[model samples]
Target: METFFSNQKQTLSRAFCLSAAVICLGATNNAWALFSDDEARKAILDLRKSLATTQLELQGEIDKLKADNAELRGKIEGLEKQGEDISSSQKTYYQDLDTRLGNFEPRTATIEGVSGTVQPNEKKAYDDALKAFQAGNLKKADEAFSAFANKYPKSPYLPLALYWGGNSKYANKDYAGSISQLQSLIKRYPNHPRIPAAMVTLGSSQLESGNKIAAKKTFNEIIAKYPDTDAAKDAHQLIAATK
Candidate 1:
């Protein structure tokens, strides 16, 4: 009976020790699980923060690139506009230079049924002299026509100039000058359209110079050569008056 009780006591003690060791192991496992959960949560938070910072940096870089691109586009447009303006200015400058050069070059022109190459200065001179004559300045007309005739003897305007010069001299009562000019025109341009009128002037100039015989002879020649002309009618009347 004593031995049975001792065995029972020993078994009870072993059971108590085993139960305490199981409780201690359970507590250590729960603590390890809590620590592992906290470490995982901290790692997740750190990863999220790093991702957010990287996104912000990337966005800043993108915005800077956009602004740089816009600035580059603006500079390119400004350069293009400047190039266009310079090209336009150069074209206008060249056109103006060409026009200035054209004035010095000779050009073809037609004047009074005569077509030829005429110098710019030559045309201007003729125009100025003709303008003076048409303004009814008789002395200026005479001088200008005479100068033109002497200066440009080979000009197509010579016959007209001589005719107008003779008429101007006659109007100024320059009888000797009129006779000389008209005779020159008649001798030089016998088939000219102004011949009949020139001969009539010649007849009148001869009469004014007291050469009636020469005047009568000129009137008869006009009636024989250009009987249908107005100058011939005037010549006939003048001859009747003289007779």
Candidate 2:
């Protein structure tokens, strides 16, 4: 009976020991699961921090780009304004030059007792032609004007002298000679202010010379080239009369 009681107590003690081991294993497993959850949470927080840093860096780059763009735009606007100002200044300068060139006039000769400060020959020749014209010596006027033109081919008055010589020829009943001389004047003085006058004379001479087509052409040319001049107005009247 004593041996049986000792065996029973040993069985009970083994059962209790087995129960304590099972409880200890269950607690260790739960603690290990809790530690794993904490590590996963830490990793998630680090990932969120990394994402925030990347986003901030991207925003900084965007801000820098905007500032650079603004600076470049300002510079471009300044250059455009400068270019416009330069263009306006250049236009004004050219306009002033054109005005000055258009208003220039030749100085007159025949100063004091002397013929002229420059070009004494021109003064003498011109004075001789005028005197003959005033005296009503048409033939002598023609001779003086012809001599002036021939001797002073480079003179500014050469065009006027030729023109008056043609008029003198017409007055002397030399219509064919007048036509020839006036045509020569028109050819010689293309840009002269007296060109319209020469054209009118040439047209009249051409009409007298029986060159009706040439007369019409000269009248039309004067009206087209010198629309604002009195000679053009006269040419138009004569053209209407002829037609």
Candidate 3:
């Protein structure tokens, strides 16, 4: 009977050991699965951080490019303005030279079935009147220019004579006479080189006479008809001021 009891105890011990080994194996497998999940979570977080950093770097580069674009635009605008100023100066110088040379050059014109020769004395008279006008002697300049216009209607200097006469009238505050003379200039000398100046003078006279509507019309005509001209540029500034 004692031997039977010892054999039963030994068998129970072996069963206990087998059950403990199974429990340890199962616990080891569960711990491995938990470790794998933690590693996967860490890798996912690191990938998200890298993507965010790349996006921030791309945005910084875009901002720098925008600033560079703005600077280039400003430089281009400045260059265009400088070019315009130089062109305007050159145009004025050439125009003055052309006006001076026109005195010595005798031009042919037909008037009333007769062609008359322009005299050197006529050039002198016109030049003297112009000098007086440039020196701001409006009264004498007007008298001289009027005499020239009346005496030499068929002269090649007629268009310039009429234009200068109108300017003198404007300087003397004779707005009506200025308008009449400038209107005659436009009608007679539509293709004259000094027509733009005449138009600007006419517009100025209109403005001086409290004819705001007429002035606006004249300025608008310049911008519409001769937008690339210096006269048109000045008219635009004056109109903007009025507005």
Q: Pick the candidate with the highest TM-score.
A: 1
After superposition on all CA atoms, what RMSD does each candidate show versus the true structure?
Answer: 12.4, 12.3, 16.7
Instruction: Kindly give the stretch of ten consecutive residues in candidate 2 with the minimal lDDT sum.
Output: 110-119
Which numbered prediction scores highest in lDDT against the true structure?
3
lDDT of 3 by residue, 65-104 (tens): 9999999999999999999999999999999986666667
Predicted structure 2: lDDT: 0.80
Q: In candidate 2, what are the lDDT values of residues 1-243, reduced to their tens digit?
A: 999999999999999999999999999999999999999999999999999999999999999999999999999999999999999999999999755554453334433221322244465677789689778899999999988877777666677777788888887868888888887877866666666887787788788777788889889988998899999899989897456
lDDT of the candidates, in the order given: 0.85, 0.80, 0.86
The candidate with the higher TM-score, 1 or 2, is: 1
Per-residue error at 124 for model 1, in Å?
3.7
